[model samples]
Target: MFRRAFWFTAGAAAGVWATTKVNRQLKKLTPESLAAQAADKAIEAGHRLKDFALDVKSGMSQREDELNDALGLHQDPDLPANVTALPGPRRLRAIEQDQNDPTTQFSYNRNEDH
Candidate 1:
């Protein structure tokens, strides 16, 4: 029984050691693939930067052409139009005003009824 137990323990230890060794070997093969992937990413980034620069150049030229046209380097759209405003109190004068008509003040407070 003791011998059997010893063999089982030894087998488990060997398994553990072998697994660690295989993992280490696999790790050793990773750097070349990682370097290749990094190179691909760098190339992709370079192309994106080139496209962005071209888009910026195109936008700047369009704006410049529009400005030149507006400045009469080419034909412009319009210059001026007519405008008007509403007349208010500033255009008129306020005169004296009144409350109850003094002409019929005594006719208040009473009437011809019962």
Candidate 2:
């Protein structure tokens, strides 16, 4: 009777352990868990793409400088890097205070202004 009781207890314990393990595995395979994993992978891929784009832009700038050096196009090494050879687009019209407001009249004298 003691031996049978011991065997039954051991069997019950084994069943519980097996059930817990299977539950954990099933949770990992659930739709919500899978979706979360896929989302994480997608975000990682987007970050990699952004980093690759920045690398490409930097490489292009470096190559542009090298080409300019080979052609002897860079005249002054001391010149400010922010300066550009061409001017940017000009504004077409001056800003007005209000669209419905009538235009103000003004008179100017060249001699008085000077």
- On TM-score, the candidate that comes out on top is 2
TM-score of every model versus the real structure: 0.40, 0.51
lDDT for position 51 in model 1: 100
Stretches of candidate 2 exceeding 4 Å from the true structure:
1-17, 75-114
Q: Residues 63-89, candidate 2, lDDT per residue (tens digit)? A: 988987787776444334553232222
Q: Model 1: per-residue lDDT, tens digit, 41-109?
A: 999999999999999999998997788767656432321122112223422111111133434322111
lDDT of 2 at 76: 45
How much lDDT does candidate 2 score? 0.68
| Candidate 2 local Cα displacement, residue 65, angstroms | 1.0
Q: In terms of lDDT, which candidate is strongest?
A: 2
- Judged by whole-model lDDT over C-alpha atoms, candidate 1 comes out at 0.61
**In order, what lDDT does every prediction score?**
0.61, 0.68
Query: In model 1, which range of ten residues has the least summed lDDT?
Result: 90-99
Q: How big is the positional error of residue 77 in model 2, measured in Å on the Cα after superposition?
A: 11
Model 2: how far residue 24 lies from native, Å:
1.8
